[model samples]
Target: MSRSTPRPEPFVSATSAAALNDLRTRLRATRWPDSPADAGWSLGVDVGYLHELVDYWADEFDWAAQESALSRHPRFRVEIGDLNIHFVHARAVSPVGPALPLVLSHGWPDSFWRYSKVVSLLTDPGAHGADPADAFDVIVPDMPGYGYSDRPTGPPLNSIDVAGLWAELMRILGYSRYGAAGGDIGSAVSRYLALDNPESVVAVHRMDAGLPVFTGDRADLSPQEQEFLDSSAAWGSTEGAYAAMHRTKPQTAAVGLTDSPAGLAAWIVEKLRGWTDCDGVIERSFSKDEILTNITLYWLTGTIGSSMRMYNANGSIPSEQHARRVEVPSGFSFFSGDLFARPPRAWLDRVANVVRIKELPRGGHFAPFVEPELYAQELRDFFRPYRKALG
Candidate 1:
């Protein structure tokens, strides 16, 4: 496929500001449901959770504070594949240090907000007391339908296509070669960046990798393989409902999630509860404000339906299915979280030049936000070897 250069666009125009105001109105007008879960957000964002969050969001959460925080970084939009993609661009300041242009992508239920903590650590590491040589020019983007990006006008876009666009985006920013990192859907995008746009990306780092191909001539053999597979099967039976809906009937389900703040909160909160790394619940790892902020982004943008279009567009990309084998140099950090593919070393080595593999002491689906120290350190170490070339 031929690549297209992204045209210029700003982060937030008057349109987005107007939309935010409208969402507050919707939150105020919401009629809560009789929650199925208990008192808190565990069973889902309960009625009380939504009421409390919406109250704070309306009175105190301060959209203005969040907006000003985001505005500190250089924000811009680029027209890619007929869609405007919004991203934050911050160049590293150290002249003596390496400044590889790094594209960091956010996965589902997360906007660019998740990366805000690590941006300064990566780009302005000297100020944060890290080695200046570890600095990188950072570019964090909200996927097509998420955050401030324009809603998908018609058809769904694939993860690989997003990666190709990022390579093109970096070239526009004057980087001939670069590096990338991702988690969850972000990891999928990073894989595409290295695999499809091999000419531009130097190396790739993955915080999460999906279900791996279990190519075994014999079905019953090793204990470890059998064990992990059995656990994965159990997870599929219970927590895989979201995957099914997104895969088959996305648009049909958007009405309820969009109409009521309580409904939207519950729908989004379930994943936060089950998918996180915490022992008890998502609340253990994230605050009610933290959880609602993600939901608010989707509610305000009406991107919930559009975001899920990835599943519909690809229509059952069978779990463990390798759409295309990626041969790029790759570093992997596997967190102790549910639904993580746990790709065998042999399989990843075939599709990628497996340079680093780390087993983190803790973390889950939302790696960066859940365990920033562990996640960011893994990023630092994995990308350390390429510092001389890109940093």
Candidate 2:
């Protein structure tokens, strides 16, 4: 590694035998809740489904295999400021041209696991029957208080702060310039990275435009944009309760989530099912192993509370950030099954110098994981024009 690139210590994800035993013990001891005779998922996580999942987790799901699978990638840890961030850094094997350095940020209730499926596809597109010129030196980092990264002991770090850390991380990796991409909270972080460091970020791509960043005159919005905002409000009225809890009373809610492994699964699996193209069945998008692996990471790391507390920190971002327009080149992919309605291209143009926008026929919020090939293709195509700068 170059002297400018901080030496990344090799890391592995390991769960002790005792920890596994304890988890099984917890599962065995779980006191399942009752539901009405016909209650399916309308109330929340279907009780019958939860029972089936919990049984699989306790009896069939293999943590050892999942851990080994995650460790198959070159995982590393480096201290960025006060937090020791964990990330997967996979370099292109063979490139038809210069491999663009790309950083992928993940959203809530997930970690680097969100990008694990796409890392190799991004790094070696030729193996997947695409042009080797599309390869990227992919870096997928676990945000502070998420995954194996250090949880905040003090005030939580907001998206802008996290964006600054990401910029520094790319610099530490010996890349003075790079592309950024993500969805959900990661979308917000990528937006800030473009806004705060337009000079260094070659371009940015996101699955969503993020919360309305425009605070300007209402007259600027097209009728479609107005309708989108109105529908967003309507969606929030029903589907936004979890965010409100995260923003306001995360600690109180964390107590139960931390104590009950099943409770943790209940909270997260609902989002996975609701936000994906999985219809009402989560397994359509994520296997039992995949779901358990994610939930287990949170359970073993004991970072769910710290992760939720980030919402509290985000609520205090300066109003200017919301008002600022991102000058860096931007791309967006609106997957049809996503929970949030696709924003009109007019609305996206309002906040970003959008160079590309595509509405995919399928996929959802967790596109990288659920639709890795399509997601990787979007990144490769969107960032192709900017690869010359990295040379």
The number of the candidate with the highest TM-score is 2
Q: 1-391, model 1: which lDDT tens digit per residue?
A: 1355445666653336677677677778877667664556544455675577677766666655555665777789977667777898988877355577789988876778778767777777678666677778889988887788877777777776677778777877778878899887888889878877787777899876664445554254355556656666676676777877887888877777777766777677777766766875567888766776677777767788888777676554444535366666789988876456575665566567888998876778777777776766777777777766653
Task: Point out where model 1 deviates above 4 Å.
Answer: 1-10, 13-25, 35-48, 213-223, 281-283, 316-323, 337-341
**Among all windows of ten consecutive residues in candidate 1, which has the lowest summed lDDT?**
212-221
Assess each prediction's global lDDT (C-alpha) against the native.
0.73, 0.90
- Write model 2 residue lDDT over 327-362, tens digit each, in one string: 999999999789887788888877889999999987
lDDT of 2 at 388: 91
Candidate 2 TM-score to native: 0.97
User: Evaluated with lDDT, which candidate comes out highest?
Assistant: 2
